[model samples]
Target: MARLVAVTAVLGLLLAGCVDPHTWPEDQDDIVNGPLEVRTHWQAFTLEQPLQINDEGRQRLHLVLDGEQYESNDLHDPKDYVNQFNPRRVDGVLIEPDIILVGDNGNEVRVHGTGSLGVRTGRLILAFGTHHGDFEDFLSRPPAIPDDIEHFEALRIRSNEPFTIEALHWSVDRHPDLHRCGRRCTWLERWLMGE
Candidate 1:
């Protein structure tokens, strides 16, 4: 259908924006209110719980995610992480830089977290899909906590080339010391990740 074709064309354009976390932006606010395609990459949190970030009344890009929860609607056990998050409202504002977290090479106040985020450029596209988890199954393997088994600092503004500290699906849930054990992990990751 022509409608489907138009949608595909629009999506192709937005995705081509190179909305990676490392893509530095001159104005961070632009990202705070860009298209869902771009904005969704900026921040993600549930209304039941939000990261209240502040710093001496100054403004900075608040890259924050609540500490892992042991039990909740999204999670029933400590072993359970966010199974599949949906960012109904992805938004943020440019605030003051984090003083405690700074880079050794410089002092730009490095910030990182496992959340959705994107560079604020020019765009207008919204894609709906799973926002988190799909890897909590690893917790059942023992010694595989959410923190260690997962890492996704979408926007750190790091001095290094690899500004973001994101881990691939495989790296996050390393294969157990067994045969074909990674099958479920791989399938789950791909499914929830829209792959």
Candidate 2:
């Protein structure tokens, strides 16, 4: 009886260790690097400065989602005519930016533009829980752009579970000397001119 009890206690301890929180798989890195599809739409409000022009002599903004590429000629550009419109301002704050994604049971997610920059931008991804109410909880809040985010190409969403990015809305501080020529103009110019 004594020997059997000792064996049972050892088994219990091992089982408890196996269930330890530290033993749980860390999902952060996987979520950040996992395969994802993100679709974003944006509307611009305050253009405090002149529009930055590309090598083609057209204004351009590099828009990216889950490795997909897009460009905008103007801040007011939209995916479709019906969906595209100028941003509306409330109390001097622009409130027209939104994003939606199609995923797992057509789950729709929306993001509001918080802020942005020439290097990186910030947004708030708001998740609405589903019928089960299991997934309705808020995911990770948006973090300030890290120093490594040098450009839009480096932007990524870090999450644990499977997540679909629905939309992004934000304004950029105007690129400087947009009227200038050569590689110095805008990020688009640098790519186009291969400078």
Candidate 3:
């Protein structure tokens, strides 16, 4: 009898992780319809667009973190940077991201971006970009930089699909005297672009 009871308890614990729950936290429901259904469908998109600086004197540059298409030269000429997410496709639209992650934040931050791609039943779309500030700052107050560079992760979601990392990049020129985050940042960009 004692052996049977122990076996049953162990079996129950094993089954818990495999069970797919239909519900999610209320805050997460908006982007993803539900927990189990949304996180599994999550995927990463990569763009071929190169990084270019803007002429507004802001010293800003645009990066393709994840998406379907690439921006054209005409757009780059004027420093428009409007098609940040490559918005030409009819199926999946590239969206501007609202949420960004930087470094290890003690806890993982959730996605809170404002735009959406017309993702269907089994797909989730993610867009990527970069800026010259602590990626964590977007979520809360920026953190003190111990090193010149850091890598950040972003997540995107849709109904019942798995939570997916939409984009990953390092902020190279975040500090005043610092120029670039060095080879690690460059390597991350190359890896993301599948170069």
Tens digits of lDDT, candidate 1, 142-172:
2212222122223322121111111111111
The parts of candidate 2 lying over 4 Å away from their true place are: 1-95, 119-195
Q: Give the Cα error of residue 87 in candidate 1, in Å.
A: 7.1
CA displacement after TM-score superposition, residue 164 of candidate 1 (Å)? 16
Q: What ranking emerges by TM-score with the best candidate at the front?
A: 3, 2, 1
Tens digit of lDDT per residue, candidate 2, span 1-195?
999897657544433332323322221112122123432333222222222212221111222223122212113343332222213222222222233322223333332222222212332222211111122222222222233322221122322222343233222222222322343344544443234
TM-score of 1: 0.16
Clashing pairs in 2: 99-167, 100-166, 100-167, 101-166, 129-136
Could you tell which candidate, 1 or 2, scores higher by TM-score? 2
Q: After superposition, how far is residue 146 of candidate 2 from its true place, in Å?
A: 25
Name the top TM-score candidate.
3
Alpha-carbon lDDT, every model = 0.25, 0.28, 0.29
Residue 29 in candidate 2 has what lDDT? Answer: 16
Poorest stretch of ten by lDDT in candidate 3: 53-62
Question: Which consecutive 10 residues in model 2 have the weakest lDDT in total?
Answer: 126-135
